[model samples]
Target: MPERPEDDDQQLGSLRPTRYATLAAWAAVGLVGGWFLHPVSELVNATAPVVSWAQPLALFLVAAILGVTAHATWRSVHVRRERLEPHRAVNRLVLARACALAGALVGAGYLGYALSWLGSRSELADERVVRSAVAALGGLATVVTALLLERACRVRNGPDQA
Candidate 1:
């Protein structure tokens, strides 16, 4: 049977891009805050005792925390939007996406650094590393944006069945 306009509207209404936008905005703010606080690419240079793992790990942790903050805000609004207390089902989705975004960011940063480090000295290496880093950053951001958009869809439409 064909879907009705009401059904389509329901589906559309179920989506809440506002929530995702809010989350992204908050995360971006957190990132800006981190930048101001650090005043340098802390992710690139290892500042702690464990440089080997600390750099990437720190970046991941920071990004994750920011994601968490964003998710929390999303959850709050979701709860209010649905006129119900935060649902575990929905909250879990938000958390999962946030974690995924954080992981992607960390991975991309590390790969960028590795590519650059491996290709050091020569102009070709420098160019290659820079290209890789930019690509990684763009990919991560796209993933994050997609995830957030998906979450927004879920918020409005309820979870999709597998």
Candidate 2:
């Protein structure tokens, strides 16, 4: 084997790329917990708080931020026109991964919450279902954007670029 340079890059820990199965597992956990949330609340005569537009709005905002960052990363890394600092790139990659897992869990939770509201007699059920579904959609977007950002953060050179 050829001798390698002694640099910090050689010492930095490498993390495996995020996988669909891992995300699915986290979502499943969130779904089960969220599915039970309503029944548990009802069992204790607790009031289910009404969901509003803000929940989905906030989730969408997070997705938008990730999307924007992904775009910038793609332009900088893929185009070969600019270079990102090593630390900044690493930080962004970490952020993307963390957000991807969070998005899956959050999206699934909201989806399960929406499912739980189906066939319910509560006056707010309709609103809850609608808002929760929209929130779930936002969570999906966050996951997609975060994954894109993670891919964009990869530093490739020469024939292995793919």
Clashes of 2: 0
Q: Name model 1 segments beyond 4 Å from true.
A: 1-9, 13-50, 54-86, 119-162
Q: How far off is residue 149 in model 1, in Å?
A: 15
Question: Highest lDDT: which candidate?
Answer: 2
- Ten contiguous residues minimizing lDDT sum, candidate 1: 46-55
Point to the candidate with the largest TM-score: 2
What tens-digit string does per-residue lDDT give for candidate 1 at 75-134? 654654543344654564565565555545444543434443453464344544444455
RMSD of 1: 11.5
Q: What is the C-alpha lDDT profile of model 2 across 1-162, one tens digit per residue? A: 676675544455455689999999999988887788888877887777567899889889999999999999898878865678878888999899999999999889999899999999899999999999999999999999999999888765443442
In Å, residue 130's CA in model 1 sits off its true spot by 18
